[model samples]
Target: MGNHVETLRWNGSAIEMIDQRILPHRIEYIACDSAQSVAKAIRDMVVRGAPAIGVAAAYGVALEAILRKNEASNVFSTSLEEGFKALAASRPTAVNLFWALDRMRKLWETHQAKNQPELADIFLGTAHEILEEDIRINRAMGEYGASLLPDGSRVLTHCNAGALATAGHGTALGVFRSAVEAGKRISVFADETRPFLQGARLTAWEMVQENIPVTLITDNMSGHLMSRGEIDAVVVGTDRVAANGDVANKIGTYMVAVLAKRHNIPFYVACPLSTIDLSLATGEEIPIEERPVDEIKGFRDCHWAPEGVSIRNPAFDVTPAELVTALITEKGIVDNTTLTAGELADFVKKNQ
Candidate 1:
């Protein structure tokens, strides 16, 4: 997912992809040669992210159509609908997953009059467009987010929002990348986001490759760092933004924002325009996804205590807009006015 959400390898009849389970450690591409296999992959998080899911769905349906003996039937349609239902059921936090999939469905139905091969080409083209546009949006976000900080600033970031998360550049990390390139000598304090270790696995990997100075610390250590005046700002990525400017991000983000607010350090929420959802009234309306207890039960699935200790893990949390300094988007960094989150979003849309 460095430069694209999903990578598809078409062997004239099948679609193959890299299994995200062992990413940034072991690179493995599994053959998603069938609709069921790909759908299961999506459900199991073998492949993920909004744009990636959409592209995967497109290819999944395409492969089904191409491999069928009878190409002029509605069987592909029925299978495609089932695949969409399965994929959409995998995760609820990232609304973009369903959004992109629905868009793909529409594109598929709209192009039904075209030849089979032509429709396949259309899906591929749509996937590629989403890929390229995401990269461009990341670059834009970097440019706009950089303007919010001064040179030689030390910043803190939570979770993973680097190239691995986006199609290319990234959202929150893109801001830091731009600052570094501008000679900001920025140091990133990474909070090893608990439960998933997205910070440790994805963020640390990105910082290492970019040669950015990064310090990894436990989730509880963030407030300590803030108290010592070691942090200048906190930037993080969001899965969804409510109409009230409340942001739902990887769990533990609300804590970081509260700390930032108390410390008087600027806290920023970086995201693409797609992450903002005007349908929801507030963060409370955002559905929180709860995972298995195994995450908090062990570091690497190994029990630390010799007992039946249960664990509670919520995938994401909501951060109120008041704690944020500015919202960085592809268009520019916009500060919310006294208006409500929904009204602010309308303002943003008009400006864009």
Candidate 2:
């Protein structure tokens, strides 16, 4: 079941990505044969989620290498550099994008003396490695996080962090999947992540496909439900996590975290260490990507807002570490609730 949704895959000559923008309605794969095309897809959100973006960027570099495999060494190097910059520019908030590109760049630097074809093979192999590693890491995170939820747990999730969001499996939804696999009876409350409606479309669709009980509610309904004790825990996926444990995720994540704190409910961010930006001391240092105004106006081809109305469509928001109960990673869960100020930095230092 976890393998059913292939977010993106290399099909020998090109990168085939599931067109997430039309997901849960029509399953389509868009082939990207060049780094520029992959960058466009990432920027346009044809393939999203931090881990998935990272994997896509890695493949983007590989695609560039493949495209330039027959060129002169200097031309190949220049082209690869352009590819790196393009993928890096695709998204600002997801640290994993840069991480994956950096990993590929480092590998290229070490083996750059080789011919272009050999370098292309090395880059492609490394891209495949990153993809496989992401799946393994997500499964490990699922196992570690599944233990946190008791049987009959009612979990609240935002955005779409299921198999559709990653190479396979998921982060937040992976924990729910793991819990169900362990025979725990759990239900999910999916927030209809506004504008994009990832929750209402992707999350709900994934849950329903897996036969998991999922209830959909408007983005504004979380606080009310929490006040009524309908929510047991909140789990969401992050685009980036700071060294101090602050999180940058979907725009509504900050609100959900605040409400979870008010209800004394655990707010867990399921992410891989790749999403952690050690250079960023706090969430303030993380760059927020403001999406196009059309996203705020309405869904595709649907408009309700008045003409020339103002809009602030920041794709992400920061949640201070103080409000985060714990961070679920492949290594283990970091319990932020018990830590004093600045201790998350210590953890990052030790782990990093």
Best by lDDT: 2
Instruction: Write one digit per residue (lDDT tens) for candidate 1, span 99-162.
Output: 6676777887798797767776676677567667777888888988888878777888988877
Best by TM-score: 2
For residues 1-352, what per-residue lDDT tens digits would candidate 2 score against the true structure? 3757788888889999999899789999999988999999999999989999999999999999999999888898899889988998999999999999889989988996788898899999999999999999999999999999999999999998888889988999999999999999989999999889999989999899899999999999999999999999999999998877889999899999999999999999998888888788889999999999999888899899999899989889999999998999898899976766566666666665
Worst 10 residues of 2 by lDDT: 340-349
Q: After superposition, how far is residue 241 of candidate 2 from its true place, in Å?
A: 0.9
Per-prediction TM-score, please? 0.89, 0.97
lDDT for predicted candidate 1 compared with the true structure: 0.74
How high is the CA lDDT of each candidate model? 0.74, 0.91
The per-candidate count of clashes, in order, stands at 1, 0
TM-score of 2: 0.97
